[model samples]
Target chain A: MASKLLVDIHTHVYLPRYASLLRSRTSVPFIRSSTSRDGKLDERLLILDHEPSGGRPVGPQYWDRDEKLQFMDKHGIDVSVVSTANPWLDFLPASQASTLAKELNEDLEQYCSDSPILPNAPIKRLYGFGLLPLVPEITTKSLLDTVEQISKLPHLRGLIIGTQGVGKGLDDEALDPVWTAIEAAGLVVFIHPHYGVDNKAWGDKDNGHVLPLALGFPFETTIATTRLILSGVLDRFPSLRLLLAHSGGALPQLSSRLASCIDHDPVVASRLKHDARYYLGKLYLDAVAYGPEELGFASDVIARSGRYQTGASVTGPAVRSLGSQRMLFGTDHPFFPPLNSTEKWKSVVENLDAIDAVQGWTQTDRDGVRGGNAVALFNLVG
Target chain B: MASKLLVDIHTHVYLPRYASLLRSRTSVPFIRSSTSRDGKLDERLLILDHEPSGGRPVGPQYWDRDEKLQFMDKHGIDVSVVSTANPWLDFLPASQASTLAKELNEDLEQYCSDSPILPNAPIKRLYGFGLLPLVPEITTKSLLDTVEQISKLPHLRGLIIGTQGVGKGLDDEALDPVWTAIEAAGLVVFIHPHYGVDNKAWGDKDNGHVLPLALGFPFETTIATTRLILSGVLDRFPSLRLLLAHSGGALPQLSSRLASCIDHDPVVASRLKHDARYYLGKLYLDAVAYGPEELGFASDVIARSGRYQTGASVTGPAVRSLGSQRMLFGTDHPFFPPLNSTEKWKSVVENLDAIDAVQGWTQTDRDGVRGGNAVALFNLVG
Candidate 1:
């Protein structure tokens, strides 16, 4: 019998077309080459506008499909669902962003479709999540056209979005049409964080990128998603499938407090059809939280959300293991790579170990999170 | 055996002197009498500057000791560690804040010391956490003097401080002396949140205060406490006891992510002596999370910190119940009260129910969190 399948749903890639587009720019989010102290030329990818030391070194690992496959092979991953990395099409004009987003989506679709098929499984090794031109000047018609375009692509199963929606936040009512279109298309919406919270909250000490990457990024996702929930968008679009990065970015932990706050606010109490915890059960979460206890805890929150389902039984055995069914394994690869070239990536190893070590997670539950859930959620089988 | 004890460590109160002081002011953080729709006079408390509808109503429950005792009795709370509510002297001049801090400390002391002794216990029904003058202009000497004074007070067990410390955030090096003094005095520091993050993130929707109170408040606490952790304050003052409100305000959930970020940053990798998760074990958390899974998850995070201790065993049963030892019960009273005048507080009942429903918790574990943890932490058994 074949070993249990291992799927990575949170991996990222930068298509060559997109990289060349970034290289052509002269401002932030651009790529430039400089000489290293060892006398070798090095390419740097700078995404943040205010980054001083250029950005971290960039190479084939970012844009090469072969490098991703090789990395997956070394880590024993059977399948990967790739998406474009951050700051995607956020800075371009309507004309430029609209054109580039279409090209990138096609490039991503082709990139995944042409990948080698697995010998032991009846599926291709690669799948992709498309991008949207959510710029300030884009027309609603253009946005819907892109959604229509992605929905027809064979290998593209979802769309990756940042917190900023059409230059406002995700909660802005202006994005309602986009949500409706995406939901109707039956495509998953992968909500990620690119712009973190303001830097003033980090205080004076220069702690490198720890504050922004670790805390700010997740908190930004939390605020944006919570705003969307409070805006009654979930009530309006109950079938909208959202997969939150970093285990919903503290949302599961804060849902009960949120429910209590809503119950106390007369203006907000009657706004939703169900409690806040009910929404948590409805959403999918990537198991990227780096600890065993956290993974178990997030699954518990997701599973308990079953009790909040409409007409569902609130007692006993019914809600058990419901969370693991919704959680999918994620590597967040091409980011948080190890400094040493020969060493295994600690980021991937930590997540894998967490799944293995999580208490009360039976073999069936672990296998579900590791691959089976993604297969069911993304319809991976041909 | 006697029924398990119930102690509230996260409860709040407003001293009569402080109320009078606010009643005299005309700006935000002040209380003023206004006519209600029914023509009865109502005292409205305006804490946030931009609150349009005046603010929530204030009443005798805020300042009357008898009202507090009655509420405690109604909730079956045998002990309460009350602290002054938010915006505490934050708007006052340094001289005025210092004087009021001193006066308020004494009033709080008298309030707790004079409460009726519990019939089954060897302690009074009240204990308190005093306020600190943590405004923009407070002098260091006066701050230390208040710490010194609170240490000498019989009923005061800790100092309640806002996120801001001496104008800068909690990570400011300027407050190192205050940390030293408080640590030396063996006083617990109860860090709370008043100022949420900047408002622009909320967008154009009028979701009432749900966004700010539910997401903003806890996120603010998470950021402030994280800044403190990244600053290595816990490393400097290893024995300084901290009791974080809102179950460490997302700290336990995000600890692993923070540690991974620290490891990946070249500048931050070598800064701390231990991983970020270790500090979580060193602190105390109030059980105000409001959900069973969240409570269980936080305890697991806290308990696992035992593995990171200097010489403790990494495996075995040593850490099984360690987290319960550090988590204390709390009610956050006088806030989030029931809108219906005659009903019990949903806020209190939800938390109590959460404690009762948490999975894997033994009767002993529940008893510890309900009151034994507070008893041991505060030395309540004189």
Candidate 2:
């Protein structure tokens, strides 16, 4: 509120060390020299099961800190709490994962601590949410050690994780200590989605990223979050702060239906003290949903979640005021880059415009979402 | 809205003929004898892959015409546009499917033409949305013939279809003729969800029906609708009118994101003439989303979708005046039955209450969603 600061917490990066690791592997999540459609050879990053277009062209923007800074400057983003993007060392061998994750975390920490683009300003332009090595057979001690290390990093604010946890899922009881460690450290857990539902399950795949990124990603987030709720993680680790990508991946709208189903199912009903909607109140979301109507709905759902128990009104005071803080600004940069270089990135412009598009939202609400929220939530000092 | 008639468009019924077919089948979508927890034997309807509790218990409420009438009376619903419940003769053999569909359509027509529960009422108390066989290897002639037959049926206003079309999904190009036939007939295509996402995709199913119904059903709807959009079905069959169950199955909220993703992707963007959000203006949604915030958001998104094209706003008149005729009222009855005998079904109460709970929604908007929209959209006559 004091000054304008646009922070993009949803931005991503792959450190030089991780890029090297990818370059060495031929499997998925690997980078290799491939001839472009126009016959130019470029290093393309193949991190997923994209069919038609093998993958995207990867260059400095993915790993170069200077490029990230340039992108921020271009988009008017003052600070960024970047994370090691998805497929992040999750596939490393069990023996190698822990050590690699340590290296990656350190590498990201180094990236964040680099000379600021605006050293004259009192802001850290590149803080980060570190990554954990969720390998099979990973010990709770190892996980907690990583959490401890991430929290101690001078510029790290939280830990970023995929829907998977310790090879099982976030619902795995084995992840209790990991949740406890992160919660105790008072760091946010950024939950992003990768490995959407089995590609074959969709029947056909001619639509390209439309199926995976559009439907698969959000559905994955929805299922993972629902599983976490059903397994009582929210109840057990009440302090564990989860920041879901894509505006809780359809959770805001589906929360009531989820709660209604739970109350209807005798088995699920006996498990939860509160309805599924109640847990939404405790979760944080990014304003990456790309529409003001969706964002406003997500905000109201969070406020109305504990409707029966909280007795809170969901007018301007609750959803807007509270949401302005909980729903921080984010642009999933380096992913949806503009097709035309001359124009501003649609992803960034749309997200920024979306913050203003929210109906009935005041300037204060806009300020909170634009940067004031990330300032307080991630403790970004200026 | 003229005399305030309360119509329920999302209601369902399992006709005697369909029940007879299920009773004969050993596979899913069957009605069979099962022992209750208290040790009494009862006929249970197993329409889905629900674990722990095999499937919901069913009896007279599921079949008996009088019970449906009584339930309608209890709920104060004036006219009910019933459809054959999900898995509706989908499993019938190709040879039998067409014949059985004809019988079922006739059966439904007879059911609707029966004497009104209230003789003094001018409108038909019961109307029906017919079912298409959509049998495998079926010729286009067969599909159009069925559409023509349904169109002739006096009380049959629309057709209910699951996400799967001819085993390939609604995107299957072979179903083009059927869509054209239905469009030409001016019959609404009620796109409902069944066979949710593959069951194994959810991992261990300790959550009972929570994952499948809450997440699976809607996600299925989302994917199917997205496929339709991506394949340019909306552009090809521009006159095709669709009534999406579960509030367009999260489509309204995700439409902008879908649009953004489409705009970002080369393959998807190349195929579509309109942005993905524009499809919302062309689709009808049910009020089954279960919260005022969700409904308001759905309404807003649909209006905003046409914002660039229509240039009309989305506050009161723009949303309700447009959304009123687009979003209809529905009670997914006999499905989410009340857990107790004394209380009204949580499904009904939650949905009705959701309409009132939407912030800034006017009385006209409420009426539009409640019944007026259904009457206008379905051409339900007096």
Candidate 3:
């Protein structure tokens, strides 16, 4: 049997091309120079409005492949499935979106195909999920063209997309062809959250980006993913291969409740082919949710999803076998850099430790989450 | 040892006075006669604007106490900690709100104390969480007056409240006194979801009440509860016991993610006295989340909360004793009544079976959840 591999499927990166575009812009997704503690000008990524901390500090780790490889080597990560971080062309002018998306996709492919070797590392183990042009007014043909283009990129296993699809949401019927094209190409759709919940929902208080990132991001993912299920997205496109960020963004936990609601609601009962729980195996969840119990709970829920119709009453013990196979280890680095500059990134450390601490997880299960699943799902041979 | 009790803590009802108020109103919370399938006039309770299905059908189960006792007898529920269902007095006029709240509290108390003996039943077992006048116009004096009155009610354990406190939200500082007063009296605050989420989040579609009930209610609960924790409400009122509807409304699942977000964000980290996970034990989550995996997952998360800093690295197995003790059985009766009149409610059966099906759960845990916890939480001594 092959030895266990430590794969980071959820780490993110900004390409030089995208960074250049952001540096020229003055909007929320733009990059600006801010004075640091030492009174030196430092690059900051302002991705949201009224950001209390004046946005996060942006460094080489964000756009530098060397930094990503160094960080991966430092953390013993065998492979990094990189993707474009959020605010991905969503703010671009429609006319420029497709062109920029194509460029960004090429940039990512180039990054993945790079054979750079670090001093202490054996090989450059980097693959990426490309970006999509979801800005309004982009032609469907152009969108499908981008998908076709990304699919042909040998190193690109999948692509990341924000909640907004064709300017509505993932549930929008207009994205049917987009979904079909992606499924046809066998590319895993990484459903990442960028635009959090509405400001009004955040209430009149300013807790900085805590509410938006923590509550807003997951809540957005939950609503969008649910909307897709509720709108029969999964039912219509059975093998769409959707992967949600942030440990399915509360989906694993809320699925039973969502299923119960659907069963009880007359409008949805007839519409859905199966309960929400049945779709748990139909989707993949990135292991970015922090803490051992959190990840363990999510794994258990997804495992239950694999055996939705288990004759538990007669069988006695319930069977759950899908979670580890579907859960891919992710670091979500660059963002959430360590508070102490010299220390290891807490975000990465916490996520890795969480998997290590997960009770009942076998060595094989850990290996599956670490790399085996990503290898199978994304066809990452190396 | 005393025989284990089966208490339903999350069940709901509408008293005579509250029903009359709904009938008199012409808004979302109003009751109106609608033609049914059999060509008979059926009283429909419209709790939201343009609600499809013309609102749920109102019957004896909603407003009649004798029917409640009979339902309890049939279901083998030994005690019930009932509360006024959603949209409770939240829509009343200011001057009338306080008065209506007092009257409703009295009515609930009377319902709980009623000693009706049914055939094959040993006791008239019913306890209740009272109502509060939460309209904007109600003064602090009136709010405290209602709290003071309910605290004095022997049978009323706590009170049910919507996510909206004083029309702003639970995070509103103005409600500090309200939280303090409720805490001071040792009333277990049952935080229920009434006004679902802003419709914008639901998008341009209608799937009946599934969006609101499944996603909206829980989403609302998650946000409101998180806000309370974010605003340091739990830190201020350490002893306050808060019970969240629908198993903490996505709280247990999203909690770890919420904590991760907080740690990443400096503003929240500096502002919050504790991480989001720390509050899991501080708040009580009902097992309204169906499926053993779902309930078990919730219980597991809550149990983790009880021992946050468990030297789990040294301790081979994680200790999780907090969930069952905190998880009180709930029917959510009348709302998700059986679609077919003659059959047992799918809602009730599913919930009960879910408890019975929880993996690794002992008979003691089941009994405790079924009634023992409520018996202790509400001090519902017969």
Candidate 4:
């Protein structure tokens, strides 16, 4: 069997500077320390946890880039397209947001540039998707300027964004300029979800991270993308490329249902003209789905949907050819950290297992999902 | 191509009596009419819709059994194991709850028994999963008695239940006797979701039934079943056969994540020495998934999990040799109604397409999902 390269496109890091900013805040997304049951001083960060308790312990692993490189080495990840973990700059003051975004992007860029500082660093090892300032009351001009500045950042490939846009959502018409600028800059939008659905949906019992991490994250991704689709983001910016986390977050499974829904509603149908399946070919998906069966199914759906777009003039063959290149490997690292004391991250291994398990897949296809896709999409190896 | 016998085990009906009850009540789950822009009466229902206009139109097709038969015939469904639609006697007063359940079960029995009254009706064509009077604070004795009474009804095959159990969820220890009795009677428990996750998960946008129906329904099913697993219902009632709607409502997709979570949490791991994947084969799934690839993937996951039990024994093959017997056909009728003008139900046909799409599946396997599974599980033909 040929050895295939493994890439982690969805890995997260809290830069040292970013961590300091979070520590200065009193609200959520902050870190603190508490007494453990063993009588040891344990640090805790409160992102989702609600209480007067200080946030979860912020350690060197969270902010230190060397720690990230060391962890990647431990996991056998060849190249990681790291991005800033949420809630990223959404709460910044408008005046300071743009400068802070630049600082964060530069900080990330420097980390990627210094990738070879560590010994035994794998070939073509480090790359990044930069962050954007998405605070409310921020002018569109400022947002567009940030996009332009980040586009030129040498190691920066794309921008990672949350679902909430200026407090409303991605659907708000005000954010169109941002989309247009990103599309014009030929940058992929790494759309991830932060604020999950209402807590009431969880019911009375505390299921720990089961409800939020398992359901909330994906559910939020699905809703956000659906809203964008309904609001005509694809129709408006046909060239816009979005890399959805968690294998399009149930979109492939629900695409047929969504298409049927559009077909049933005459008002929506007349306004939308084409079906939801039509837009699916244009969208890019990540192989963050846990199992190989899911990965294969998602790939099959992409392949089948690509067939539908064959006849369209401008978008037909280009979009179809992009099918294999459309999906990249993503590991939601530092989040689903191994609770078990294993040396290797189980989360990362399961994802690699999925890539290995996709049957009848050519080595080229395997290479594409592992590292080649990210290389081509983000121009990573240049 | 060989002709496949398509069975629909997931279909639902409101029944005339149930519709009338809804009409009488002014609260949620009730029906009312509002004047449209053209001054015409626009009927609506308020389960997901919260407007004062109330719920959607409660038509004859929702309640009338003959209409259901006609729908089945039109769709070429060989057999349908029908169940009452959601909010099934869940709101009845305590004193009258069980009596009303008896009345409804009797009505369904008569309907199935007298199917000869319909034109060109086949013998023993219609069977049902009966309703449980789950509301009004019934005693454990009465609940068990109700299960016993329903089992004795000739046309009744099993019991249909919602997530809520005496106001708490399925995990509540108080519901142990109910699960025990239902398992002992060899009656299949058709677990469905009525109350979706909180509406706050849905942002302020009228996507017109997209969020609740698409995401909420499946998410609710996943949560309820996870609770059951965490509470060790499957461990105790090994014989309990659960037919999950919506292709186990994202259970197949999230099983890996759930297993990882259990492995990570000491509290969860301490309770059960076995892995979470070991419990999946003990449960059964319905073919309500909208696509063929999804169905195939779901089946593959069940097969690979290696959790199947012969009876109550947890240690065995991951899946039984009776693969098709474990899954049944379902249409989810009365809901997802065709918005377009068409004689054939699109929802039913899509599911049929899924059944036809599963690769390498044999005719016997197809037959079992179509009708034979329901027949054996519910003892319908015998």
TM-score of chain A of each: 0.96, 0.94, 0.93, 0.90
lDDT string, candidate 2, A107-193, tens digits: 888888874844545778889999888978877788888999998987899988998787778898988888888889999999999
The number of clashing residue pairs in each candidate reads 0, 0, 2, 20
Which numbered prediction scores highest in DockQ against the true structure?
1
For model 2, state the Cα shift of residue B245 in Å. Answer: 0.5
lDDT (Cα) of model 4:
0.73
Native interface contact recovery, all models: 0.75, 0.72, 0.65, 0.32
Question: Against the hidden reference, what TM-scores do the models get?
Answer: 0.97, 0.96, 0.94, 0.90
**Residue B308 of model 4, lDDT score:** 26
iRMSD value for model 3: 1.6
Clashing pairs in 3: B7-B370, B7-B371
Deviation in angstroms for B293 in model 1?
A: 0.6
Question: Tens-digit lDDT track for model 3 on B1-382?
Answer: 1237677888888898888888887878889976779998789899886687767778778999888877877777777888998888887788888888889889888887875532334534777898888888678888889999999998888999998788788898888888899998999999998766677777777887877788778888888998898898888999999998988877887888788788877777777666678788787878888878778877877777644432323333345545777887898987887677777777877788888988767888888787777767876555
Worst 10 residues of 2 chain B by lDDT: B309-318
Q: What tens-digit string does per-residue lDDT give for candidate 1 at B66-88?
A: 99988998999999999998878
DockQ, in order, for the candidates? Answer: 0.72, 0.66, 0.66, 0.37
Docking level of model 3: medium
Give the TM-score ranking, best first.
1, 2, 3, 4
Taken over the whole model, the C-alpha lDDT of each candidate is: 0.86, 0.82, 0.81, 0.73
DockQ of 2: 0.66
Give candidate 1's whole-model lDDT.
Answer: 0.86
Model 4, TM vs. native = 0.90
